[model samples]
Target: MPEREPLAPAVAATRLAVRRALAPYAGGAVVAGVSGGADSLALAAALAFEAPALGIAAVSVTVDHGLQAGSDAAARDAAEACRAMGLEARIARVEVAGPGGPEAAARRARLDALRAAAAQVGARAVLLAHTLDDQAETVLLGLARGSGATSLAGMSPARRDPDGLTWLRPLLGLRRGDTVAACAAQHLAPWQDPHNADEAFARVRVRRSVLPLLEAELGPGVAEALARTADQLREDDEAFRDMIDETIEDIVEHAEAGIAVSVAALAANPAALRHRVIRHVVASEFGVSLTRTQTLEVGRLVTDWAGQGPIDLPGCRATRSGGMVVFAARA
Candidate 1:
């Protein structure tokens, strides 16, 4: 066991967050995403310090996006810092293929590296240091996309990856300043990634431009307000999702590319519940989620349609093909 040092407020908060996120999957190793920045480095330190008591170990992983000139050196510095903190650290360099565009390619590459590192260590989960500010940004971005509750609900603290590994964000409730403060309190110099300030990214635009404007105009607590809205929406969305799951157990049937909903069963439900059911079916089966306008279209399909007709959607199409409504991708 490592000697206990007095943890700073930021470090203590980080520790609590990490512990809460991993409580369900006790005693398993956690792969910490270390980007050489203050946020991730502080998270790495907290996890390393708390690991012994929790019966879990922490491994640091630095994904070199290979986009910047000194990215490799930055990754090496990150690994060295992790090693100094008594964590086993490794660097994964990834090539960013641009067919999907640079940002998309880099994101896929980064997650791929993180997943690969977790697999190598036999870790069941990965910890990401996304803060409260990030969550607000996500919510605002989702709003700008005109997407509904699920998109506005933003990221989950713990989500199962498609491959069954878990990805957790322990620092989601804390601010970026807190992470920087933690590094300063520990006498650690954390790197500032230049990309964070670049206006090329929408997130950067929101963080640097929109948030500041909102704070100035709305009086300082706008981020908290937005985050609160996201939290409430998340709760509502989860309940609705659960209802849909249970409803599907009774009302859904296998179809060609998607599922078919029994019109009689669906029509019996209240308007709000029926809307959620339709949204869930579109999102789950055909990977199509209705926007505000699309939701109205779906409502018409249920209530106003006197006869069978088609409703066009992104990635798929919906229609009253028979007595029951069917949603499937167009052949």
Candidate 2:
């Protein structure tokens, strides 16, 4: 008999990434969120190959946002492909609604459905197919928004959601082209989303125009550089979070209406940590994010105090009360 060809480099690389990602979840059930696109299809294929070896019972979930024509059929097709690879599959049909435009609404709905599916299937983790290219695009979008380090930090490889389901992205170190090549090597045909080519979306524009322009002008490796920046920022953000946790415990006190932080402590800390502490306090207390202007305005209550009256915030008010900066719910 002829010797079987070795696994293609791209296919081997993708499977290796998935294997490492699922190592910690050995013997646990995992759901791969497959969109039928090349990236997700490659992920599903890799999970199917590696799950059994790692004692993981894998399931592929195809979330149908029903945004486009034939979306349901496409979702079914994705599930069928997963089953063909010897993995259990599910199709989650979800209605895309709420604020934040169509793309955001669809994404939110899809994620909710994925989490629900994971719970139904008793899976502890839902693996996503976001690659290095996606991470770079996320960083660029964050930069465009003029966001802080936390926002620029981009997506983590693994994160546990509020519902206690872990989300994993194993391919963040691989390029999108690698996934495409892997699909081809495996003889898997991927469904192409037309929206990916539509320039109406900001992400599409970044992927199609902005990234190419950067690569052209800068020679190459722009995406890798952006992904590296995200990794570095994430490390810094983690350290800062640790510092904030320790400082908050000592400097924060429960107030009658809300929470209060020691004004002297906040003023003494460096501006970076102080601002984050203020933002964290407001967000944790009132569940509302403060704009930069709002944050700085509140900061002035400590750094540039001039007996300013109570400042009205979205869900609360910030006022100076002797030694503490009190954040009280708006009456």
Candidate 3:
């Protein structure tokens, strides 16, 4: 008997990733955020293939940012591709106007549109096509900015938003090349966004030039190394978050103006956790982020406590009162 034809590696990899991701949400629906790009089209194809046998329902939602001419047609083509794959598809038109630049603003608008599409289909989760290359680029940017572990941690594979919607990125471990190869293997035509090639965006520069230079200078696996760093940091960050949540329940208390934590308890913990606690407290109570400087100053109120007056924060003030480090609203 003749040997059976082996499945293409790219097709096999994409299918495996989608199968693993759809397991948890079995018998439920999910929305795939497709951009008609190689990554997203590959994701939609994988979802189309894997979701059916698992009793999972999937929909493709393409957001038209209207940033360029013919964007609506692009959205329609994406949806038609999904339809050809035997999945329901939708197009959401959004105006990308916000504080951030075009890239950031488009992302914000796209996410909002995706969420609404998920809501329409009663999907509890939205699947994105962020690949390992994206994660590596994010880590590079984080490193360049000297950001905290939260930034270094890069994007999580899965995250639950406050509104009960979950975001899942199954391709975080797959390379951008894998997606491109998968699309080619399946004979799918992916739309190339002009913005991706435009060097005006910092991310485009990283993708087009910086990453290639790093790979040439260092080695072939530099991108993989950066992504691995992100994975390790994310694990550490998760553990610290669990610890902080438990500690917060024990030491935090309601106050007249805001919130407080036991000074002795704060001082007893290691500096790493102590700083996170202060930042968490201010963020939860005042809805403002504490800089590294601000976090250290609030931490000093616990360790030093030299009768310094309240140090004003963005939306609150920190002071040591009695046996508690109090964070109160700004007067």
Candidate 4:
């Protein structure tokens, strides 16, 4: 790929990833999540130095997960790095909790902090430093779980944040080593989080255990190939979602508590789109999401359970009433 001006290849690649992810906000300011790691620091430095003329303003945000003893100091260090780059920076601390487990809890808190910071700066987009390796790990983990496309596809480059702001990944296509090289070139100090090397985490196990094995057995480009696969799946999923949106627009019936779908209209769609459309309806109407098993059960209902009673979902039920499939919560 061609280099973005005034930045080295690694930095240029980082910027390209972020810019492409945030293409919807072509001329807007961006809030970057800088975790003081090589990847994030390089991204912060590159965006600060390379994006002004491109009509992109940058803000650096450091989230202190508060998991380790010195996480606060690390956040401060990240903030200092941003200041050194001549960009405004903020240090946000989040107290990660349970019920979702530690990993997911930490992620939720970190995103919450980033979103808050983005809002404070009036930024409409938040940029993250997830690399190609992270994408591969995600895909592998998803594959291990045996879920369908949504899981296997891994993360999207850009998506809606919790606060409804756009979240962009500008380093998803670059390797971790490239970010390290960029840090070296820029003389920036990057923090090495010990949790990354800790084998206790599932992601670490995937990164340290699964990925290396795949590289040795399959090929050197295994990680890249996995990430590429995710990108392809993401594209396919998006197109499928667009088709679902169109179908919903044409055949939806909004009720007091939830929505109903015309059984005939749903049956007309292909099985793939049919399943997706049913899941969308369940999610939109009752704020309930279907699991893989639950989704298949719902799919079976389309043919076998034509005139049956209500089927249970996460937060609601799907019932065949008259000529439509109604999704509703029990009153």
Best TM-score among the predictions, by candidate number: 2
Q: TM-scores, in order shown?
A: 0.89, 0.97, 0.93, 0.89
lDDT of 4 by residue, 1-331 (tens): 9875575777667666655665666577789999999989988877776667567777898988889999999999999989889788888888899666999998989888988887877889888888899999999988988877988889887788455798877788789999998898788989999998999989999988999998999889999999999989999998998888666888878865788888788778788888888888887766666877887777766666746678888888778777778777767
Once fitted onto the true fold, the runs of candidate 1 whose alpha carbons sit more than 4 angstroms away are 1-7, 22-26, 97-101, 161-164, 256-258
The lDDT for every candidate, in the order shown, is 0.86, 0.94, 0.92, 0.83
Residue 261, candidate 1: alpha-carbon lDDT: 84
lDDT of 2 by residue, 15-97 (tens): 99999999988998998899999999999999999999989999898999888999988998999999999999988888889
Superposition error at 330 for model 1 (Å): 2.0
lDDT of 1 at 105: 92
Q: Compose the digit string of candidate 1's lDDT tens values, residues 1-331.
A: 9997876888778878877877766677879899989999988888877777778878999999888889999999999999999999999989899656888899899999999989988899999989889999999999998877888998888889677899999898899889999999888889889999899999999999999899998898888888889889999988987888777878878788777888777788887788888888888877656776776686777677877478888777778766577888887
Q: Highest lDDT: which candidate? A: 2
Tens-digit per-residue lDDT, 101-185, candidate 3? 8778989999999999899989989999999999999999988877789899999999999989999999999999999999999
Backbone atom clashes (below 3 Å) for every candidate: 0, 0, 0, 2
List residue ranges in candidate 4 displaced over 4 A.
Answer: 1-12, 15-28, 160-164
Q: lDDT winner between 1 and 2, please give it.
A: 2
How well does candidate 2 score on lDDT at residue 45? 93
Listed per candidate, the RMSD to the true structure in angstroms reads 3.1, 1.2, 2.1, 3.8
* List of clashing residue pairs for candidate 3: none
